[model samples]
Target: MAYLDPRPANPAEALTELLAGNERFVNGTRVHPHQDAEHRAAVATAQRPFAVVFGCSDSRLAAEIIFDRGLGDLFVVRTAGHIVGVEVTASLEYGVTVLGAPLVVVLGHDSCGAIQATHAAMTGTRLPGRELGAIAERVTPSIWQANARQITDYDEVGMIHVRRTVENLTRPGTELGDAVAAGRCDVVGMFYRLADGRVSVLAAESAGE
Candidate 1:
């Protein structure tokens, strides 16, 4: 049987599809045989990715594998801790506004080195250069806030960062924000576990919920 395209009219269905894909992956029942040369040729003509992903640059957390999706299925942007910088935001805007992706997932992962580095900096432990320090600086506020709340677990820190990135992207007047408010796109946050390969969504108000 052909797989049903899970591009629902609302974002919730998009998210559900992603979650179900992850479950399939964990259960070792992924269905991506179409990623071969024949499928690649077919997709060469045009692409209609259903979702936009902003995720950490971790090697183990590739969006396609985790979500059990094939080529031309996702527009993905990766950076450390999935931080929302100018270039990243611009890429996501293009995906939402031009590519017509219905959902945007800001994905963080367990034991993220970025979050750990930020925590180290917030605790006044030295990290190397100005370049590395800049990343820590960008993520420090979230770590500090999480720390203040007595939450020290790395998973929680990563989740907090994901939530902050989502909030930053969804603020009013921004292109992503406008897309979300107009119901043209949705921004959701999730956490990926490196050990078990499970994804836990962070936002309570998921699109179409």
Candidate 2:
């Protein structure tokens, strides 16, 4: 038997679905969608994930669980601080170009250890090893940006990092950027509130009419 997915076809529709799922999560009335056995078998050979969720590797930032989505609902990519690099960019591009995902979401969270460490590193309090330092370097700009605005909060820095990540993805000349320019997809940055279980949209970049 064949199964069909009712996932959204365009970027705007995909964003709406994600927002609705988040609402269900916040209300604690989550009816987790698309996790049944039949759904699993249907997607074994092919997947039609609607959105590409690029988020942090933090334990609490589970994309499917937090968004109330289930099997084959999202193509997820995660890294510490959700940093961008060649691999990360290539993976996200594959999700949009090859998998036909319409939406790419950059998910960040409050009280993030990465942001905290970056801030501490900038303030001369923490010096991470070479490997971890690379991650800190990627997140350093947001810390600097926050400090420029006299913001001392780590959550504010984390939000800035999220927006920066989305901007990096959609910047001119990149594959994702070209796609967005051509009206093929959208990139959104969001902050997840650890205490409230809510995801707030920070920035959305797409081809404008």
Candidate 3:
């Protein structure tokens, strides 16, 4: 079967499509023609992705593969810890405003190194360089909150970060916020388990207009 644009009118439907696709991926029965040359050429003319995914830059967690989506099917923005930086925000803006994507998923994963490093920093463990420090700094607030709750596991910490990041995207003046408020987009958070290949959605509320 060809890769279909499953951009549903209801935000909940969009979420369902993503979850269903992930189920297909976990079962090893992904749909076809997503990466083919013919499909690539067809998408070269114009693209109409159904959803925008903001995920971590972890090699083990590929948004397309995890969602069982093909090229041009997802407008993906990836960064360390799935941080919502200016550039990442801009990319999501383009995806939502320009590409007309109806769903935005902030995808974090289990055992994320970024979350671990942030936890270490928050716990007074020295980080090596400024580069790593930057990542730690971005994630420190979530780490501190998780630490306050006595959550030590990397998976728990990562989930905290995912929820915080999704909250950040929903804040006013953000592209995600605007799109969501206008009832044109939905912002959701999810966690991908590397071991079991399951994606757990953290939030289900629609970005109400």
| Estimated TM-score for each candidate | 0.90, 0.94, 0.90
- lDDT tens digits, residues 1-209, model 1? 22234344567778888899999999999987348776677677776678898999999989999999887788999998787678988999998889888899999998899988877776778663688877887898888768777898888878878888888888899999999889998999988888889998886544432
| Candidate 3 positional error at 161, Å | 0.4
* Worst lDDT 10-window in candidate 1: 1-10
- In order of TM-score, best first, we have 2, 1, 3
Error of 1 at 197 (Å): 0.6
Best by lDDT: 2
Candidate 2: minimum summed lDDT over ten consecutive residues — where? Answer: 200-209
Candidate 1 is scored at a TM of 0.90
Instruction: Point out where model 1 deviates above 4 Å.
Output: 1-9, 204-209
Candidate 3 stretches greater than 4 Å from native: 1-7, 204-209
Model 2 stretches with alpha carbons more than 4 Å out: 1-3, 204-209
